[model samples]
Target: MNTVKELFRGNIRQYGMVIALLFIMVFFQILTDGILLKPLNITNLILQNSYILVLAIGMLLVIITGHIDLSVGSVAAFVGAISAILMVDMQMHFVPAMLISLLIGALVGAWQGFWVAYVRIPSFIVTLAGMLLFRGLTMIVLDGKSIAPFPKTFQKISSGFLPDAFGGKIHMLTIIIGIVLSLILVFSEWRKRSTQQKYGFEVGSGALFALKLAAMVAVLNIFTYVLATYEGIPNILILLFVLIVIYTFVMNRTIVGRHIYALGGNEKAAKLSGVKTQRITFWVFVNMGVLSALSGLIFAARLNSATPKAGVNFELDAIAACFIGGASASGGIGTVIGAIVGGLVMGVMNNGMSLVGLGIDWQQGIKGLVLLLAVGFDIYNKNKGVS
Candidate 1:
């Protein structure tokens, strides 16, 4: 019993969010008369939350560096407008247009990074300016108009999915993919444990490791099943998966990742220890810009058009998701998985409420309260040294 309690203590934030998610899901499942978990709605939940997950991942890194980004949403909108102009008005090819949009995002990041990192401006100020600047640029480019009917290839970025095939009754392809992914994840974990053991660090027990692998496999299988039941796995899902893996690895295993955490934990100490604070800050924003662009493209593809008002207030959702997911506002502490879970919780709440015919007013108020409680809990836990 003590051991189980210790496990929960060690993983309190994760478990907390997971418990909240389950509770909300169950409550809404009952409220909606069993419509909350319909395979189609479940799949849509994943699709709808994918962009938030993307922005959340990048936001995690930025927050880790003890900073915040208020411009990701505007940057996304700007990229979507550019892509629309290039594809629809200028009649550009899909690949080049996409590349240009990405480049524009990178440039926007670089611009903000320069002010925040090199010019010694506070991130809040720089990003506040960026929030306005990019929104203005988007309006200028789009001229308060909507662009539509992008090329088919571009539409596939979000709407396309793989066929359900591989073996027989099951979505063989999804199952196989899940199994392969599980293997890769387990192998990676094994390697990590081996490395820790070699370094004479406390490697978790063999049984613990096995249990972890089992949990991962179970999650993958369940997710694949849900997607298979709906319409197969989406291409955006694939992209989101790859980014998660890559970013997770970076945050967990790489030197740069360490630098980010170190900077977040204590900037003075990190700088004293020779962490390139400016460079890392610049790169973090650069990565944020790239992901924002990618998210913009996905959003456009999903809508089958780009509107002048795309991505309004999206930055708030991403920030709220990160904070609600156990990230410290002061920076230096957060997890990629935690951010994803937080985004999913918000997504599920929004979806369930909508399904139950809840009004926007009540929904907003409830969500705001939930966010406050979550962040307040984190602060309380930190003060109590609960973890």
Candidate 2:
């Protein structure tokens, strides 16, 4: 019990943020007269935030590695334009076009990575240049036109929902998926606890662990139920889920993940320790490019078109999500789950404000204040520790 309390004491910030998220949800749920968590609204929430969440996952890593990619939004727009040109203008298949676009994105990553990791340029400058470069390239590719009315198959990527094989009003598939995921969550938590105890590492108590697991199961089941009542699940939700799980593993359970943390903690030290700082840094941007490209496709599909202005301010959004999720301003900290939660915070606020018919003017101001407070909170805690 004491160990569990100690764990909570150490991670008060993360848990506090989670509590804040819940508080906001409940507040909005009441303010909107229960429209906030309606089945339809819940589905829309996932779909709306799916692309940003994807970017957040990548941004989390880049920030952790002590860098930022200002070019992701432009990269997404450029790749999305290329996808439209291939599929619509040239009448190519979406799958092949998607593959090609992803490759191009990777190459773009490699290009910027070369400048940052090898040539020793600052990331902000490199990606800022990349942001302009890709935006210009997107306009040139599309001739400043918005390509629209994608094929049914392409549109399905964003708008399609999983079909219920059971054919009942209650989404049996969603519930089943929820059950499977809950079981996995339980098993993983138990194994992790056992391993930590075996190694004499500090761990939350078994009861705390159980309670957390129970919460996870409950939330998963509830979210699944919400979707089950509506369209079962959005296809993009699956993509986001896969990404979150993969990234969570990569950051928590892999050697590369450890190396990233090391580099972020102290670049010179990590290099002396043989962390291959350059290689890791180079690959980080490459990964960002790939995700940007993927997001471009998803965003374009959702809109049913590729617009020249498709990705305006997307980088800002991604950066905000990372920082709001508790990523340090100086980097070397943050988590995949934190990024997701942060993005959701942004998404929910955007949604709730819109539901209340607030103007864009007020929305932007409120959001800005939230971001400021979030970062401010982190800075306060940081300084307090030193004091």
Q: Which candidate is the best by lDDT?
A: 2
Pairs with backbone N, CA or C atoms under 3 Å apart (clashes), candidate 1: none
**Candidate 1, residues 153-268: lDDT per residue as tens digits?**
89988888877656455567876787788888889888988998999986556877798789878977887887766677888888888888898889988999999999999988
Off by over 4 Å in 1: 165-170, 186-213
Deviation of model 1 at 210, angstroms:
4.8
| lDDT against the true structure, each candidate | 0.87, 0.90
TM, every model:
0.94, 0.96
237 Cα displacement, candidate 2 (Å): 0.9
Total backbone clashes of candidate 1, pairs 3 or more residues apart or in separate chains? 0
Per-residue accuracy of model 2 over 95-157 as CA lDDT, tens digit each: 999999999999999999999999999999999999999999999988999998788899889
Judged by whole-model lDDT over C-alpha atoms, candidate 1 comes out at 0.87
Model 2: runs farther than 4 Å from truth? 1-5
